[model samples]
Target: MENRWFAYLIPPFIVTLLLVAGSQFVFIQNSFYQDLGLGRTGTDLTLVNYIKFFTDSFYLKTFWITIKVSAIAALLTLFLGFPIAYVVARMKSRLAMFLLAGIVVSTFVTIVIKVFGLIIIFSADGVINKTLLNLGLIERAYSIIGTQEGVVIGLMHFTIGFSVLLLYSVVVTVPPSLEYAAQIHGASRLRVYQRVIIPLCAPGFVVGGLMIFNMCMGAFTSAALLGGGRVLTLPVLVQRTVMMEVKYSTAASIAFVLLVSVILINLFSLIAIRRLRSARLVVA
Candidate 1:
């Protein structure tokens, strides 16, 4: 069975690799060419587009902003998700199980609908702003839409359900014996989680964080709908450049940069996690 497993996996893996590599090859070719207007591009190989992406401050700023926003969203999702995941994982109550089911259902809703719903909720005249105004939290309707804060908030909403689900699965895998042992050794409930559960669930946290970060990095709808041109992310910029300006080369350039950034960041995070895990093992 073990020997046959590779044979089963190899064919699909090759096919997937070919499809992904083929599309990326096209992007690489497109990135080298110069846009000649009207969805046309020159075949002449040049580094002009790549140079422009690095040299221009606006493009650089957008790249950094996208990274920053993604990081913020990832962190916020983790912060808000872990507690719910822990609760769901450890819960014996029917109500808690029902709530977990609701959270799982939330992830299945179409992201387009979710983005539109978020837009309505974050709009200046939305229920939240109206409520805040009525409560004297502010003088008038505070606009969350068309801002980075709005984009991050929407991303948190988008990611938290998935994060919770992932973390819940991870937490469930951890044997209750370890936690019970910690408690038997005079550790308080908080201490058990802090010293045992959290450390044991480190891999889940990393997986959830990376998933959320990657989603936010390439996310278009939230930035487009909530950003309202005020928070231009790399994906939104790529869309505008291709559709509005017909700059295929530039758009490809932006996309290629984003791809590289995501890959490098993922690599860095994986390496850091491995190092941390190794150090933790050494300490133990």
Candidate 2:
């Protein structure tokens, strides 16, 4: 019976592989051809699109901006989420479940609704600006729309809940007795967290940070709505290249570049982390 049940998984697994990896393979393969405008491609394979992306200042700037915003948002999300996750994970009452459920529900809410909510709050006549204006905080209203800051904020909002959930799981895995022992040994609360909790959670932190970074890199709705067309990330550029410019080959090349960059960064990060761990072990 167990063998029969295991057999049932193979078909869906194959289908998923075909739909996901197969499509990506086909898309990336198109990048080798030259774009001839209007969704057309040259018959001969060439590296012109990739070369143009590398040579053009605009494309390079957009690529860097995407990495910048994603990195900033991922780091910020981890910082903001850690405290909330710690508090919830350490809770003794049923309220912890309620809080986790709330976070889960809010995280799953549609991105369109969330983006519009941000726009309303940040608009010139909106609550934040009005309150700041009334308090004489500034001479004029400040807007995040069409700004890199806005994109970062949007990305943070999108990933914060996930970060909290990820960190919560990590935090819970750490035995409470270790924290108690640290405190009993004359360690301060901050010291307990710094010395006992953080080091143990380092692996989880790297994995969670990478996951959040990857999400921010591929995010489109939040970037599009918050950026207000002023900031262009690689995903946004890919969309414009395919839709507005009608250059499928160019868009494919851009997509391929984004994919490769993400993979390379992740690989380097994991390598650096492993080296650091090895050095720490040697020192100990």
lDDT for 266 in candidate 1 is 96
Per residue, candidate 2 scores C-alpha lDDT tens digits across 14-51 of 99999999999888888999889999888898999999
Best by TM-score: 2
Error of 2 at 87 (Å): 0.4
CA-lDDT, candidates in order: 0.88, 0.94
Candidate of highest lDDT: 2
> Which ten contiguous residues of candidate 1 have the minimum total lDDT?
275-284
**Per-residue lDDT value at 250 in model 1:** 90
lDDT of 1 by residue, 1-284 (tens): 89987789998998998899988888778999987877789878998899999999999999999999999999999989998888788887788779888987888787789988877875678988889988999997878788889889878878889889888998998889999999999999999988998888888888789999999999888788888898999999999998999888899999999999999999998888888778874122
Candidate 1 TM-score versus the reference: 0.89
TM-score of each: 0.89, 0.95
Instruction: Give candidates' CA RMSD values in order.
Output: 3.0, 2.0
C-alpha lDDT of candidate 1 relative to the true structure: 0.88
Any residue pairs clashing in model 1, and if so which? Answer: none
Counted clashes in each candidate structure: 0, 0
